[model samples]
Target: YKAFEPQEARRILDKLEIHYTPKHGSWLNMAEIELSILSRQCLDRRIPNQEVLKNEVAAWQDKRNSISKPMEWQFTNQDARVKLKKLYPTIQQ
Candidate 1:
């Protein structure tokens, strides 16, 4: 394996910059969620060829676009408390 010389490494490092994202802020999560939905809704079946897969995905995309279902997050903290009450253990103080 070839290793970069010290001067070459310094030169490369000088041209690079690094940035950090804010905590708990990532659009990647939304992308993953959409892909998971796509897998469940459209990719659950086997496709004989690439052409059929492309057509199926395109049709699914068109149908999804036509619906234009707006995402609504009406589930509040209170709703979570009630729905997940069983998941939380009761501790007597």
Candidate 2:
């Protein structure tokens, strides 16, 4: 995957009309975090089959939805500029 050329990937995406995040962007981080939480809370144990897994995940989702609140994201662009400075390229003026 790492060996794949960015230009080739971009060409494919352009052909497919797919939008993408910039390199090193945390666009998928929140969903990844949620999956981690779900794994810890409900999926850590081995389930015998897909049906059991589905039921367990559904129950977990119901319980989570019942108690869920909107997330207040605190990381601003300025915060990202400071914390993830290396991830961004310097602008030429």
Regions more than 4 Å wrong, model 2: 1-27, 87-93
lDDT tens per residue, model 1, 5-60: 88898888899998654354355655576689889999998889999999999998
Candidate 1 structure, TM-score to reference: 0.48
**TM-scores of the candidates in the order shown:** 0.48, 0.57
Put down candidate 2 lDDT per residue, 1-93, tens digits, no spaces: 265699887776677855565354475885677799899999999899999999999999999889886455778899989999999899999
Worst 10 residues of 2 by lDDT: 18-27
Q: 78 in model 2: Cα distance from truth in Å?
A: 2.8
lDDT of each: 0.78, 0.82
Which pairs clash in the backbone of model 2?
none
Would you list the clashing residue pairs of candidate 1? none
Q: What's the true lDDT of residue 20 in model 1? A: 56
